[model samples]
Target: MPPGRTVRFSLSLCLLLFSALTGAFAAPVGQAEFERGVAASQRGEHQQAIQAYLQAQRAGFDQPALQYNLGVSYFRLGDYAKAAQQFAQLTRDPQWAALAHYNLGLVARRLDQPDRAADHFEQAYRRSDNARLRALAASALDRLPGTRADAGTTLSATVAAGYDSNVALAPDAETVNLSDNSDLFIEAGAVVNHRLSADSTRARYLFGGLHLRQYLDVSEFDQQSLRLGFNQEQILQRWQLDLRAYLDNIHVDSDRFEQSLNIAANARRTLGGGRDLRLHYQAGLIDGGARYAYLDGWEQRLGIDSLLPTGAGWLRFGYQLELNDRDDLEQNGEFFSYSPTRHSLFARLTLPDAGHWRYTLRGEYRYSDYDDPYRISNGTGTTEVPREDHRYLVGIRAQQRLADRTALFVDYRYIDNDSNITAYDYARHQVMGGIEARY
Candidate 1:
C-alpha cells in the first residue's frame, strides 16, 4: 500500500509484461510469422525477431503488440530513431498510448534529451488508466533532470576544539631530545566551490579553502594553510572521469613553511546495486623552507578503491602505493635521505542515520621501506642502515544533525608507529568536537 512498495511492484510487473507478452498474442490460423517473431524475441535474438515481425507485417498482421515489440527490439539494438518512430505510432492507440509514451521517455533519456524525456514521462503519468502504469510513470517523472547532480555554488564552514596527547614535532632518528608535550588546540576552516560550466555529460568547477589551527600553550606550533584548485568531471556511458590540479601554501607560526602543487586523475565506474569502483593517481611537487627544507621533493601515489552499499549506508576500502622522493640532506655532518616506498591499506564504514545521529569508523595500516640508509652514532662509532616502519591508525566520528544544513560532530583518532629507528617510535591520541554548516 505504501508508495515505495507500489512503485517497486509496478516496475517488476512492467518488466514481466514487456518480456513475456509474446505468449499473449494470437496469430491467425495460417499466419505463423507472428508466432515465430514472438519465439525469437523470447530467445533474446532481437535482430531475428525484427525480421520475423516485418514478415508478419507483410502478412497483414497490424496488431499493437507487433509494433510494441518492434520498438523494444530497436531500442535494445541502439537504433533510437527507429524506436522513437515505432513508439510514436503506438501513441495513437488509446489502450497502448500510456506504455508507448513511457517507452518514448526511456528512448529520449538514452539520447540525452532530458527535456523531451520529462515531457513524455509526464504525459504517461497523467493519461494512463492502469494503476501500475501510472505509478511507474510517476516514478520516472520524479527522477527527471532536476536532480541533486545539478551543478551550482556551495560553501561550508567548520570550527572544532580538541586535545592532542602529543603536540611534539615528528622526530628524526638522530633527534633524541624531541619533545613529547601535550596541548589543547582549536581549528577553523571554510571551503567554497563554484561551478564554471555544466551540461548533462560534464562539469567544471573552481574550489578553494582556508584553514587555521592554534595551540593554547604552544604559540610557536600554530599552523595555517590556503588551497586553491580546479576540477573537471565527465561521464561517458558507464564511466566517470575526473581531473584536478591544486596549489597549497602552509605556514607555521605565521611564517611560510611549505608550498606544493598537486595534480590528480581519477576514474570511477558503477558496478550496479549501489556499488562503485575507482582508480586514481596523484603527483605532488613540494618545496619546504627554513628548518624543513630537506623535505623538498616530489611524491606520487597510485590507488584503487571500491564502495559497496551495506544496508542503508556504505563501506569503502582501498590500497595505495606511495613513493616519496625527498632530498638527501646533511644534519650535524651526517648525510641522510628521507626517500621511502610505502604500501597502505585502508577501510571506512559509514552508518546510516539513526534518528538524528550518524557514525563512521575508519582504519589504516602502512609499511614503509627507506631507499637509503640512515646514519646513527654510537658511543664508539657511526653506522648506517635502512630504516623500516609499520604504522597503524584508527578513527571514529559521530555526528548529530541539528538542521538541514548544520551538524555537530565528535571525532577521535589513535595512531601508533613502530620503527627500527628508536626516535621514530610513538603513540598518540586526539579528540575533537565540531560544528559544521553548509549552504
Candidate 2:
C-alpha cells in the first residue's frame, strides 16, 4: 500500500484500538450523556454540555471521539485550562490529534502565550487541510516582537487612534447621509513582558482601554472604556499554551454601564514553516444594557481560524459562529427570549517584497441578528429585536518609509452592507493621506 494510504489505515486501526481499550464495555450512561451533550451543544449551552459529557466520561465513555467532544465543550465554556487538559488525552490518537493540537493553540493564545500559541498553530496547519486555521495562526506572526526584542525582556506600549465617520451607526444612510461628523477614537496601553526562559517563554499582562470613542459633538455620544487582563505563557517546540482573564467596562454616549468579565485559555500548534492552524472557544457574560442594542442577549462564541501557504503570500481564513440567547433584556425578568446568531469571515493578503512600501489587501464580512433585548436592559422597552446584516469590504494601502522615524501613507477603502434592521444598510467610501512622525 502507498504510504499515505498506509497512514490512513494505521489511523483507523488506532481508533479501533482506542475504543476497545476504553470501552472494556460501554456503561449505561454513555448513550444518555452523549445525547444530552449533543442537545445542549445544539442549543448553544456549552457549560451544560460540559457537565453532561463529564458525567458520561465518568460512566466509562472513553472513546477519543467522546474525549474530543468533551474538550470542545470545555473550550466553548471558556474553561481553557480544562479544555486543554481534556484535549491532552487525544493527542496520541491520529484520528483527532491534528484538530486537538489546533484547538490547543487557540487556548494558548487566549492565555496570552504567543510563542507557544504560534508553534501549535504551525503544527496543526501542517497536519490538516483546514486552510482557515493556518491563516489565523499566520496573522499572529506580525503581532509578535521582532528579533531585537527576542533577546531579553522588554516593556512595550502601544497607542493607536483612528476616526470612524459614523459614530451612531443609524439606519439606512451611507456615511454620506450622516452629517460630516465622524467618530473619533483613541486607544493606548503598556505591557511588561519577562522572558521566563531561553525558549522565549514570556509572561504578559496588559491593562488599557478596550476602546474609547468620543463624538466630537455631543457629551452623550462620548465613550470611555477600561480593560484589564493577564496571561501566562509556556512556549514549547511543537505546542504553546496560555492562561488568561479580562475585565472590561464601557460608558458610551452616557448610556448605562456595559460591563464584561471573561476568563479563557487557548493554544496553537505549527505544522509547517510560516503556517499555522488554530481553534478557539470562549464564554463571557455581559452585565449591562448594550446587549439590548447589539445581540444584547447574553452571548458566546466558538470558532476556528487557519493560515496556509500559497504561491507568494499566505491565505487567511476564520469562522466565528456566535449565539446570543437571553430571556430578558433588563438582565432581570421572567419573560421574553431573544437568540441571535453571528458569523464572521475574514480574508487578507500581505505583499512579499521587502520594500519601503508595504501593502496588504483585506476584507471582512459580519452578520448579526438580535431576537430580544429587553431581558438585558432595565424594565422599560429593553428587548433587542432580531435582525440580520451583511457586510462586504475591500481596501488597499500604500506606505512610504522615510528616515528619522518619519513616514507617509495613503489609504482607500470601500464598504457595503445591508441589514434587515432599518438602521444598518449603507455604503462607506474613505480616502486618507497623512504623514506620521516619531521622536
Candidate 3:
C-alpha cells in the first residue's frame, strides 16, 4: 500500500471526528443521548456510543452530524455494513457530501469492495472543496486496484541512496575466504498506471515500471529492471478477486540477466476486527542469462497471508510453497532438475506512536531444503550433497513525519544465513536513512 493512500484515510477519519465535534444536531428530545454518545465515543467506548446514537436516531434525530457520528461508531465496532449505510445517506447534504463519500469509500475498502471504493473515492475527489481533502481523495483513488477508463492515470517515483557492508553475501571463513566490501549505492524506480475499464464492480488497468540501481565501487553488481503488466480487479459480495499478467526483464552489469512472463491470481476476504485473509497462486517461465542456461526453469508458488489483532499492533503472517523445475543442462552435459521447498515466518511489533515518531520492530526466518544433491568441487575432490539453508533476519525502523506529504525514516537490518555448504554461510548488517515524499 502507498503511504499517501493510507495517510489520506487517516486524515479523512480525523476530519469526521472534527465535524462531529463542531456540527450541531437538532432533536429536542434526543439532545441528551447525542451528547452522551459524543462523550462515549471520545472515551473509546464505541459500543456504548453506538447504543446512544441508535437511541438518538430512534428519537427522530436525523442530521448529517448525527449520522456521521453513528457511522464512525459503527465503523469502530466493526460493523461496516451499518457504517456504509449511515454514510451513504449523508451524501445528499452538500456540506457533508464529500466527506460522507470518502467515509463510504473507506468502509468499502474494509469490506473488500475495491471497485466500489474507487467509485466513492473518485466522487469525493470531484466534489471536495478543500484542496487538501481533494488531494487526499485523489491519492486514495490512485491506489485502488483499478479505475474507470476516463479516470486519470497515476505516476510515482522514488529514489534512495544507501550503503551495504557485504554486496555478495559470502562466508566469512572458508577455503575460499569471503570478500567483504563496503560501497554506497543509489536506486530509483518509476511506475505508471492507466485504467482500462469503466465499471465499478469490475475494473482493469495497464501498468508499467522501471527500476535501476548502481553501486559506486561495485559496478559489476549494478542492476536494471523493467516490467509491464495488466491488472483486473473484481468485487463479489464479501470477496475481492485480483488477476495479473506481467512480463519482466532484468539486466545485471549491463548484461541481460533474466526474463520472465508471469500470471497470478489472488482472492482476499475481509474479516471482523480489522483482519483479512488472502490466498494467491502464481506461475512463471524463467530464462537465465548464463551461457549454459543452467538457471532456466518453471516457477510456481501458492501462498496465504493472514492478519490477526494483538494487544498492541496487529500481527501479519504469510506462508508459501514454491517449486522450481530446471529444464537446462549442467556443465557436464547432464539434465539438471531439483525441487526446493521453503518455509518462511515473519512478525512485526509496532509500538504506540510517540508524537510525530512511529517505531516498528520486525523479525523473519526462512528455511529451505533441496531434493537433489548439488555437486561442489574443492581443492582435492568433488562431492554431491543435498543442500539445506536457514536464514534469520531482524530489522528496526523509525519514521518521523516531516509534513502531510513527506516523512523521514531511518532503518537498520541484520541477517544471518547458515547453510550445509560452507560457501553459502554468511552474515550481513546494513543501515539506511532516507526521506519519502508523495505527490
For every candidate, C-alpha RMSD to the true structure in Å: 14.1, 19.7, 10.9
For all predicted structures, in order, the TM-scores are 0.66, 0.52, 0.67
- Put the candidates in lDDT order, highest first: 1, 3, 2
* Top-scoring candidate (lDDT): 1
Give per-residue CA lDDT, model 3, range 268-359, as digits (tens): 87554345688989998888766526667888988898765455654667877777776544564222334567777777776544655778
Question: Which pairs of residues clash in candidate 3, taking residues 3 or more apart in a chain or in different chains?
Answer: none
In terms of lDDT, the poorest run of 10 residues in model 2 is: 1-10
lDDT of candidate 2 over 343-363, digit per residue (tens): 888877755334456677788
lDDT of each: 0.77, 0.59, 0.74
Please give the lDDT score at residue 313 for candidate 2: 54
lDDT of 1 by residue, 325-426 (tens): 988577764667778899999999877545557799999999999998987777666788689999999999999976645789999999999989877787
Between the candidate structures 1 and 3, which one is better when assessed by lDDT?
1
